[model samples]
Target: MPALLIDRPTCPATQLHSARRLIAEERLHTLFQPIVSLDCGVIYGHEALVRGPAGSPLEMPDALFAAGRAEGLSMELEIRCALQAMKDWSQLQRPGKLLINMSAAALSQATADGRWQRGLGICEDYGLQPTELMIELTEHERVADIDALRRGLTLLRRLGVGVALDDFGDGRSSLRLWSEIQPNLVKIDKYFTRELPAHAEKLQTFRALLQLAETFGAQLVAEGIEQPEELRVLRDLGVSYGQGWLLGHPSSSGASEAAPAALQVLASKEIAVMPELRRAGGSGITAEKLMMPAPAISDQASHEQLYRFFTEHEDQHAVAVINAAQQPVALIDRAQFISRWAKPFFMDLYGRRPCTLYANPSPLIVDADTGIEALTRVLTSADQRYLREGFIISRQGRYLGLGTGEQLVRSVTEARIEAARHANPLTFLPGNIPLSQHIGRLLSSGREFVAAYADLNQFKPFNDQYGYWRGDEMIRLVARVIGAHCDSQRDFVGHVGGDDFVMLFQSDDWEQRCEQIVGRFNELARNLFDAEALEAGGIMAEDREGNLRFHPCTTLSIGAVRVAPGRLHRAEDVASAAAAAKRQAKHGALAVYVMAA
Candidate 1:
């Protein structure tokens, strides 16, 4: 039947006619790709991609949409694509939601043209409720009327139809659009997902965007994930949904479930060794680290566009207008714009004028790479205006995102909590939390490691005799010794607590390092003690029984456990096994025990 359609068009002149005939003849077909839940390993939904008849000139979506746009029939063409997908998806009897793509222009036009009503009718015809469908906004065409688009989407969402923004963080995707539309899900661009394990900047971007998603009460769908490593990283980032060839390929047969191998990857307990933020030259955290989703627009845009943008994005406190060079030109406060816009004759006089008429051309605009510390010291940075009306965040004079005093303070506060988890205060080494976290990364990466548990012996009695201040000095001595012996590049040394430390050794000479650590700690142990305790060979202190007794001087006991790949499922399990080995080492004469786990 498809063969009866016109042969692939060879001339540009025939493209429009071919598109019209393609729609008239109902030549479009739908392909479904399963979007799977990263956390639960279930099929979340299927995105329906429309294609023209096989071997036709319009077989590819980009060509087909281009033809439609060129012919001024995009609204008709998009409706046909969506309605056919709905018809085919209903026939496939697939569970979960069915997602269809629509250009913002077409969506806005559909509101008054009744084409959307026809789509709703198609859903009902298939016994599918409005809730079963999701309209994903594609960036194929620019949106000319922001208010119309918002109203159209609002109507659909009101009727239980889900809304999403496709290829987010790509092309002209605006944070203002994100804030204004409040999509149920945002499909992250493939650029960020590709080779994600090697890109720390991408990881940090996703982390910030994830926080933005949470703030808006929406989920993120990482798209174009073609590697198991990418999928693992997305899972670690707590992304809700994922769509890519790694999970399932788009097929005409409409495979609604993930493939067996992909399912296995999802079900695995492996944690991704997520790329960590590395600062060059010990640079402090930059302004980029604290960025949330704030949208920017071109200065050439009209005031009506700005007005509609503010009306749609009530949650957004501010919007930045950038020049053609992508440098920020002005900042628009939501309240200020709306208040001025509400005045009598304001819309009648300036609705169509350039938005810069009302914009603050001298508003705060900071480079994205500006250090967070420098930002806090700026005059009036502590003022309430920036908290309510955010400033532009740019990189090399080009807009990157937005920031505010409120989020800056919040980010610093949150970072302190993370800093505490990453390192212990007294010892200033990696803390217990990072100890387990690194173990998990090693186990997931299939790397062999030695888990060395170090404990200070008779430390309570020593503390009782010398007091906490002296005990702290003793603990510091142990930390210094342990840190000095291990290869900082390949091994992790963590101060779990007072007198207790953990080392995950990836070095080949781990055993030698352990022995050196024990010898070094014992050598330094005497210096923390007074002459009287040193002369007595041990200190007089109460034991666990609370009886006054002569206790041995503080000495370090080292327990080493060799952990091979796949020997443990959980990092905590490895930790427990190592701790068990430590107890055995404490009883041994050598004060160091090495055993396979």
Candidate 2:
């Protein structure tokens, strides 16, 4: 290993050097990488990154940091870079933190006399509040005098400023530093993040570190998350904040908002955790592809006015009867309205009874957040009983829009036809072919995602004892359980034959959905098994060797693989990895095992 050398120069000499460079040329520039809130999906702050100017060979951060050390002005350079970063990115001055990288040696030097006072003055000149600024300490650098370091940190804290341990876990002193420093934030280094999906042990270590950070009352921010899959995995591991190229690349302009191109990149990077319907390049039809936006009606008139409007907008098959506030009150089908108009004599004797074709508000509804898969479920429900014309969607008892049975049927039919080409006959679901296609799209999209491989624990034994009929029922029950957990039309729950099922969860509510599936499946499974067999806690089955044996009963073991962005290149790799994680969960006696890190 190469020796780690940190050089120092007198503050005045370094200041002159930096000032001359600024006057002669633009030696310094800055980039802002967002540090986002995991819970709310909001930009909580930005970590200001410094780089040398375009023409300089020290254009990269590693090269610049090394050059500063070689020039024997590491601390001065660091300080100058941080100050420049603040000035360049000042537009990001929101109700959020601004992280500026600081060398431990510079801080130590500043605290030696009353250097903090001068530094604080400079901060004031830059229009930054102590509370808004965070000093990010490079973890590898040694803080020689613990008392001095503690004093400086304490004083900064007193001024209502925060400190963070940067590149945390990259060196030996991280654990010790945690006890001594007690910073407000701990940024897990990218080294650990890179191995998350493939290395189980490292993932556990990362999780433990996060938990340790939480115990110390520090927020955990995982850095170097460059892949869609990696983001999903870290999110599942309960990381509170993250920054990476996949989320958004750094920009020196201090622009806080994500641009359209950036948003497109974020959206396209599909991890298995994202809903399946969102994945691209499958050539398969889905509800998302078929569904049209709800037609908006502005004019609010009485029933007569609505009748006339429907007549004018005859091309519209179905229209929502919205009130003045734009709340959907009822659905008016073109056929029903025209039919009623044709038979006015029928309404004259019946007093508008025959013409009044109003769908009940309870069953005919959909929310904006409702996914296509969940919408499909509502459409499929026998108990809900959708009308021939359409269903009315409302929120807070206010009408929002309308969904037609014909539209839904058309969507399902197209999907069903496409699914049939690659479906397993036994389960009547899209098989490995379609599953692989979807997974490939997910991997290619480069978004944070989760791929869950759900399998029935001790299922073979149950099948052996109860025979195929009960086994089929179990499979159907599992399908229903998986289906019930799906919310978005993009979210996919597919039967992969037998007891194995697959689901892709995107968005933030995946964990909750998993819990729901587990709870509901357990409740449903208990009644499916014979009371005696269930009580015995063992079921007889034939193993791979073909000999009959009694196997211990167990719950479903779902292997959830969180795909970090840019971490994975293929869907098959993810599937295999998830299967492996499932086996790990089974061994550890866990009902659900998330692939570590």
Candidate 3:
């Protein structure tokens, strides 16, 4: 207000004049948009937006900033906007913290000769602490010196001011910048967060971004989330913060709370659906998911450094040694290295040598993309050294992380248990829930399979005469016969309660297998009956109409339904079709009946 304006422009560009006047007179408008915490559903901070006078051509942020930038007033204009936003924020006592954008050019230049104090002086004049401010790096311009920018950001962080990288995945967002600056927060671009539920590619990309954020120890702030689905996804994906119209629109009066719609989404108790685990080339359960982020060292590092690292950090059980190409070539167990180094004068003699001399060059190495199920099977055949040395997981031949045999074993057991949790207590086979899930997966994958229903003929009459003791044995015999005949890898056998079983076959020899089961079962079940009943060739049991009749020997019957891809979509539909085929088989004379559904 005291006329600290820059020199007037020579050209008659009204836009330049408008930009200067707004900065000089302190008449620039500022709106505040809330960046809410996705976890707590509470306001985390407000991003300050600077605009020109209402209804003016320069009122838009792009035009207004362009005008200032053209006249070489970028730094001066940014400081003025910061002051305006800060002054308003303090007056209104906004909740949480305040975020203001600083162009890369301004931020890097300010660190050259301590010009950053000018921005600090503005904060001091407004009676606000640096802790209440967050500097967002705008990507509108490239930094002349990134080192200077990093220094400036470090100074701000030391002074209790947080730093953020804005609109990540666009513009200046790069791995170099991310590693060098080490920002406290990263605001994701709109492209990944908008209508996230409808875009599969975006969903997977966002998941990888979340992992990257975790690796860098930075919190994620999803920008431009306008839909309810987008908010839920970000929240479920473990994003820390979010901003969009759905959360709260930009307002002249700072919004101090969450929007009603966002509150509703946060109120949901149901867990969000996760992205599919089974990606192409691997089952969803990969070694990467189970691998511990165990740190790796270069093979060129000295043995003394490795020893000291292990001594200082006791949690690491082993250290991997990678070559110049970042490929893991060896593993050093802490126990083994420490034992060897503890010998008298061992460190003095060998500590100066490369650590690779003490490492196992042939450690178990597994590709990160390999399915954990396959890894489990491989480990089952591995020598005892696998348990001692653990394993290395990599992707594209580059080291990713380290995994132990214990971790792999535990994960596979848990996955198997979780898959068939609803299993039959008697036979320990999958029950109805797992049966449906398997059928559903096969249908979803468009795989052609044979759905077979297995039932014992004259089972009820046998149970009534032989009592529950023999009856259970009869059922067990049927389960054993069916299980032994089917190919375990290509077939799924489930018990659908008492004398009823479901078998989903992917093998080409399913019909022969079914017939074998029937033939083998008929021979085994005859042993359960008494000699008198066998000699008489029948038993006197009440028929369905309540009259006594002769019942023949108990035999095995199987009803088979051939399912083609695209013919059935639902699990219930397939089950019903298979059941109808079984009923048809029951009225026939053949031991194994086949039909299509």
Candidate 4:
């Protein structure tokens, strides 16, 4: 047998002295761990984690912070760590938000003495705006004054700073604090994320927290995601942002690298999943994800200057020309510029002139919000010259980056293929596979909305009398009516199969919208029958029991379920509730029933 091992605790004096020396000498350092956006597969931000002196007793973060708290130096240590982290981050000048950890005690103290302003001042000195820095409140210690903390956070917000609640679901009062503070972001604790794919309870808990965050208008970040399985599960659950060792590890240097190979593969797989999740309507991919950062030249730059830039960067296919307002005016293709300059007597004619003379007058430009499919349509319709020149991606009419026609084509093809596999053939609406995923996504997003399930009452008899073709027309007609009533940008309308359909209403006036759909559907459905059937108000057909009978014209019955985040956790639960409501609606002719909360 191995020898027995016993651990000894450090003395109070020793711990206190270590903490004091660490603060006095400023031996603390910060390591940056990248937080990635699951939706776009890019680095959303970098969270700065504090580190103690190497080979010292307080090298670990828990030991350092705990020691500081024991020795009454928590506030001092916290401020010094934040200052050092910001200073290090400033040196790298990386784009995206910088997340800094702060304790409740430290925050309360900083607000009291106006030290928080000094922190913001340091940030400004480093050329960072308040909006770019996110102060993450760690739950190491209980807050003494909740009201004072809120006041401090409100003041910070006024300065354009973003606040985040860290390690949520680990502390007893986290839920209460979230309700009172309404932070801009919430990070779920590692306990919930670790081995999440295997634990049903953990997954359910995470789903609940996701809903809670959505209800508060706060974005959720999953922490300590070390496994690809965990990442996949989170992505499927519609978690928008996450940070984990699997994506990237902490680095002393400020360079936050791209996600690892495994994660890249997972990100690609996520794109395929997007079409299924968004089948009811939106594009899963946006221009922002496809854009590549290219050098932008001032419109006033001389041709000689532009030539030199192209010569130095052999890999550059195109460059953007921007005006004084930083709006893209034209895109200069490298080959065109080089060929023009290489012509005989070209230098003498225009070498000294501004590059704008050679710039394409009408460069292709697209907004970052443009969907990949829509962008493809624009590209395919454009002249061949524009396709070779590529297009500039912009946000709010300002130049962001450049995207090549090649990338757009590839993305569009993949999205189209994925969409075709899941689309319903009869009505061309998204099928049940996408419907279930969409419902789960909505619930995970934490927004309270309405889900309405529609079934055509007495559809079989009408189909029996009118033949399959007319039945198809009737189903298609109902789909058109539902689409007309829905806000295409906000609501999701899907065909579950046969005469059944589902709609997710996110608009504030969902009740009125559902009523409108019901009323319109009843009116439009009548047109599917002939004048004789309309006058008789019935179709002669064989009933399900094989008995001859006169069936009334088909009518629509809708069961609407109002979903509150915490109350309904799964898509299956929502479906069951909606089904129950639909049963009530079918009891009456041309009716809708919205289930109570």
Task: Evaluate all candidate structures by whole-model CA lDDT and list the values in order.
Answer: 0.81, 0.66, 0.80, 0.79
lDDT of 1: 0.81
- Order of the predicted models by lDDT, top scorer first: 1, 3, 4, 2
Q: Write the per-residue lDDT of candidate 2 for residues 424-444, one digit (tens) a residue.
A: 555555567767877776666
* Cα shift from native, residue 196, model 1 (Å): 1.5
Model 4 pairs in collision: none
- Estimate the Cα RMSD of every predicted model relative to the unseen true structure: 17.5, 19.6, 17.7, 21.0
Pairwise lDDT winner, candidates 1 and 2: 1
Q: On residues 451-513, what C-alpha lDDT tens digit does candidate 4 reach at each position?
A: 898988889998888899989998998899888988654577788767888888877888887
TM-score of 2: 0.44
lDDT of 3: 0.80
Q: Each candidate's TM vs. the true structure?
A: 0.55, 0.44, 0.49, 0.44
> In model 2, which runs have C-alpha deviations exceeding 4 angstroms?
1-26, 91-95, 139-141, 258-597
lDDT of 1 by residue, 266-321 (tens): 78655555554432211377788767777777898998999888778877788989
When 1 and 4 are scored with lDDT, the better candidate is: 1
Backbone clashes counted, model 3: 1
Q: State the RMSD for candidate 4.
A: 21.0
Off by over 4 Å in 4: 1-17, 171-173, 270-597
Number of the predicted model whose TM-score against the real structure is largest? 1
